[model samples]
Structure formats: C-alpha cells, structure tokens
Target: MSLRLNCDLGESFGSWKMGLDEAVMPHIDQANIACGFHAGDPLVMQKTLTLAKQNNVTVGAHPGYPDLVGFGRRSIKASAAEIKAMLQYQIAAMDGMAASQGLTLEYVKPHGAMYNDMMANAEVRSAIMQGIAEYHRPLVLMLQSTPQAEEHLAEAEQAGISLWFEIFADRCYDDDGKLLARTKPGAVHSKEKMLAQVKQLQEQGTVTTVSGHTLNLRADTLCVHGDNMDGVNAIQEIRELIS
Candidate 1:
C-alpha cells in the first residue's frame, strides 16, 4: 500500500505570509502550489516551485477563485465559461513557473470554494474538467474521492483528463464520503486521530466516517495543508508508523 502524502503549499501573498511552506516541504511527496489569483505572487510562485524541485517533491497547480482577500476560500458566482477560464489561466501560470525552473506541474487541484462547489455540483465539476482538458492535457486532476467522481468519471475520461482521488489527513468525512464542512463539529481531525485514519487507509484501504459509516475509498494521494504546522509534525510520524 503506497499512499502518497501531499500538502497545499505556496499560499503566501505579497509581503503577507500564510504558511510554513519551508518547514513543511521536505516532509511530503506532492505539493499543490498556489497560483497568484488565490494566494500567491509571481515571486512566491517561483520560489515555491524552486523549493519543490530542490526537495524532489512532485508539483501541482492549486487554482482558486480570484479572491485574494479571502484566500480564495470565499465562493463567487461565475459562469461555466468563466470557471473554465480561471482554471486554465492559473494552471498555465503554474506550469510556466515550473518550466522556467526545468520542472513541470504533475496535477491540478482547485482550491477553496472552487473545490467545494465542484464537489457538490456535477455541472461545475464537468465544466472545470472540460476546461482543464482544453488547457492542461495530461496533468492529473486531484479531486475528492467520492461517489460523485465515479458518476462524472465518464465525462472527464471523454475529455481526456485523468483523475486523482484524494483523501484528507486532517479532516473528517460524512457518510457520503464528502468532507464535512469546515465549520462543522468533528470536521478537523486531531493529529492522533488523523494518523489513525491514515493507518486504517493503509491497512484496510478505507476509513470510518464520523457517522460511523464505513466507506470504501481509494486514493492516489493524501493531503495535509502546509499551514497545518501541527499536522506538519505528524508527517514524519505517519511515515515512521506506516514504514
């Protein structure tokens, strides 16, 4: 059972810093780096990719709404066309940044509200997938590992997009396998419990939700937020435990 660990990184904007990326980079297998619109600047993007290269961590574009003030966590209404354009633009910038350093983006993960919206709405998910298929062919799309993905897999496959199923190391899930909203109780798993969940996944290829429902979920990767410094410490612990 080779479960890869991923982290959302490079979220700093301008002079304001948002994460402990430097401290977290060396511990993970893949990095979902932020593009400028959400919570990064050109310099920050470049530096983040450079660090990824240095650490030999795989890189992916993390695009979100153009809400810098909200760290791309705030939802904004946009047409399907508009959603496609935003994803394409951000992914292109990340790819270019990677290329400049003789690297390449390996996947795409929509951030914040964009991610949540896509998870809940097949229309939005299909639109976003169609958009990525046009601009970033060949890069895997990292999305939640839910039954919804199976329902929409055909459309994405038709568009020539590959999907990467992801489970969170620091979050809780509903019976449906959709993540519980962050505002809800038991949404964020504690380090001990998070690692236990990881262990369960490694050993059983599934996890028990907060509702005590067993979900048969598989993953190409597991995620830990770079800003989750406390979670960062557990990365080493997870590796040691799993090893």
Candidate 2:
C-alpha cells in the first residue's frame, strides 16, 4: 500500500499560535485542519487553506467538541443526535472556508476527544458515520486502523461513505490495535523507534504492540504530529523514508 503522511494542523486560536504548519505542510501529503470548534479561527482556517493550496496538500476537516478552553481534548457528554448535528455544522463551516480558497475538503477526521470517543464508543462512531452520510458532499472518513477494521469498514459501507484507515507512526498500540493512552508509560515512541516502526510498516505491513505482539494493520495513511521544529525535522525524515 502507498502510505501517505497526514498531520492535524490549523490549531492556532486568535493570537495564540500553534504548530509549525508552514514548515511541515510541504513535507506531508494530507492536512487535517481544525475548524473553529477546537483550535482554529476564521483567519487561521483561511491561512491554513492557503498554505495547503500553495504546497498542493490535500485538506480534510478535523472537527472536535465545541470546547475552546480544553482544546477539545476533554470529552463532553452529549446525545447521538447532538453529536451528529455538531459534526455536520463543523463540516459545513470547513467546506465553506475551503471553497473560498478554491479548495475542497476531501475527508473528515474527528479531532482530539471526539476521535478517541469515536473509536471506543460504537454509538458515537455510528453517529459520525451517519452525519457524514447525510452531508451534501461525498467525503471519505479517515479513522484509526485496528483489529476491528473489517467491522469499521462494514459500518462505513452501511453509512454509504468511504473509509481511509490510518496508523500512527510514533504512538504505541495495545494488543487490540487501539493506541495506548498517552498517560501510560512508554506510550510514545522515541524517534529511533518511530523510524523503525515506519520501516517495519513499509516492509511487513504490521506494527509491534506494547505487549510485544505483532499486529497486522492495513493502513492507507500514516498520521504524524509536527508541532515544533524538532517535529518538523522528524516529518522531513519520515517524508524521505516514505517517499
């Protein structure tokens, strides 16, 4: 499989700048942009779209819970209908922003707590899928690839949407193929180990889990975070390796 690298970006809110997006955008294939609900403002979203266009990077909506203070990292209690409405609103807003820049959002990847909740909660996952299905534009849904990938594919198929499974290059996974919580010990891999994981994925189409079990995961994309200069450098190295 051809592996495309994706990053969560456009996280700057007002005067608070976040991420080296200009430096990292050129090296990545896909940009999952935040859409105001989490970290982006109107200007930031427009700027990010412009940068993506200049670099010829594919853009996707990265919607999250409507929590600015927590950066959408904290989960909120909401019903399935509320979640669906929230997702559709964010997506429409993003599509509008992209259209203004002569660009189109190709996919949707929920951000932060929403992403984690989607993976762990079937009801939330279904709600998200249903929301995407009801959208005006046909867009792919990018989600984590786990042992339950087949099930996820079935759900997406039922929702009448396409799915792009993604794997994390620098995060450790549990036996069930879910990413280990960041609070856990050794949850994040070192740069050397991250490179090794990328190499293994290129060669074997698998990842070694935290419990030392080899898990087979089919991935169309690889997710990486480039928040700083060091991260930008790592992304450059990853680009070279994957390219």
The most accurate candidate by lDDT is 2
Tell me each candidate's TM-score.
Answer: 0.95, 0.98
- Model-by-model lDDT, in order? 0.86, 0.94
lDDT of 1 by residue, 1-243 (tens): 788888888888888988899988888889999998889899999999999999999999999999988888898988999999999999999998899999978889999899999887878888888888888357888898886657667767887898888988878888888888788999989887898999998899888898898888868788876566676688888767666
RMSD of each: 1.4, 0.8
- Judged by lDDT against the true structure, how good is candidate 2? 0.94
After aligning candidate 1 to the native by TM-score, how far in Å is the CA of 41 from where it should be?
0.3
| RMSD over all Cα atoms, model 1 | 1.4
Q: List the residue pairs that clash in candidate 2.
A: none
Query: TM-score of model 2 relative to the true fold?
Result: 0.98
